[model samples]
Target: MMHSLAVRVYYEDTDLAGIVYYANYLKFIERGRSEWLRDLGIDQAAMKENSGHVFAVRRIEADYLRPARFDDLLSVETALVQATAARIVLDQTVRRDDAALFAARVTLACLDGSGRPVRLPKGLAEALAAG
Candidate 1:
């Protein structure tokens, strides 16, 4: 796995009926992937300062399977499904304990200042692999 992050749904994270808002799950998954990269010494700001590169979500196809509720402790699991010179595929899942609530397959790209594609930094691709 790339990395996993635990998140708790607060009242602010939920709808009036106590169900988590759909958009919040996307926020959780995004944080999971960011933390995964941080674990590998990849800081978006530092990457730009040092190498003039940054990573961006080029496309995403996500599914919301079940509704999460307030106070539910969920885990966001991230894994690298594939990689190329300029792009990567990340598989992410959100689970409440043992129950899966949502999932996504995100296609991301590395880009320079102009937003054009650029090759991933050396070792970045290797680090994205599951252990």
Candidate 2:
């Protein structure tokens, strides 16, 4: 399943040139992923408190395709590409209307409080698999 989130580019998200800062694209995609998980009924805070595990970015490959200006309404789309016991791969894209402004492949690892790799919690794994 693909999930989409709407974001409005703010002045603070841009550079002096009024174009979105390159790194803010990452933030937009992160929000997309967070909302995606939320929609799947995975609560990160409760997962952390009950299981002592959290999801952390393990890798990200991103491309800045075009410029987004302040106040532009953008849509960030996220989809799960693959999932494993302790890792998941997702594809995300940011678009201004129908034009793609950015794209990324992100990997996340499940980690214990000690920062050691751990299997995803049972419910999260089930949710991802079902989705």
Candidate 3:
């Protein structure tokens, strides 16, 4: 099963045309990824204090299937597409219930303070594999 979260479009999330701005799609996908990790008991705050490591988006490819209008309650679904020693790929989608409005694949690399590549916490890596 995929990790899911609901995002209600507010005026701040939209453009002058009252549609979700193209770039904010990334934020929705970020939320999905955050919750995905949270579900597996990965505490982002604790990670930083203990490991000095954080996950950073290394790549993203998006497809705008349709427009999501203001006030639309959208579901952001995220699944682990791949996970390796130092990175994870997530298949993220925004849907209005059953209708997909946007989709993307996001690759995030685990990094140290200087942005050098680092392995994900061993437990989190195993968690992704289990999923």
Off by more than 4 A, model 2: none
TM per model? 0.92, 0.98, 0.96
For 26-117, candidate 1 gives per-residue lDDT tens digits of 89999998898888777877889988888888898989999999888899999888889999898999999888899999998999889889
The sequence of per-residue lDDT tens digits that candidate 2 reaches over residues 46-99 is 999998999899999998899999999999999999999999999999999999
Clashes of each: 0, 0, 0
Q: Report the alpha-carbon TM-score of model 3 versus the true structure.
A: 0.96
Judged by whole-model lDDT over C-alpha atoms, candidate 2 comes out at: 0.95
lDDT score, candidate 1, position 15: 90
* Each candidate: RMSD: 1.6, 0.6, 1.0
**Clashing pairs in model 3?**
none
What is the Å distance of residue 40 in model 2 from its true position? 0.3
Stretches of candidate 1 above 4 Å error?
129-131
Q: Would you list the C-alpha lDDT of every candidate in the order shown?
A: 0.87, 0.95, 0.91
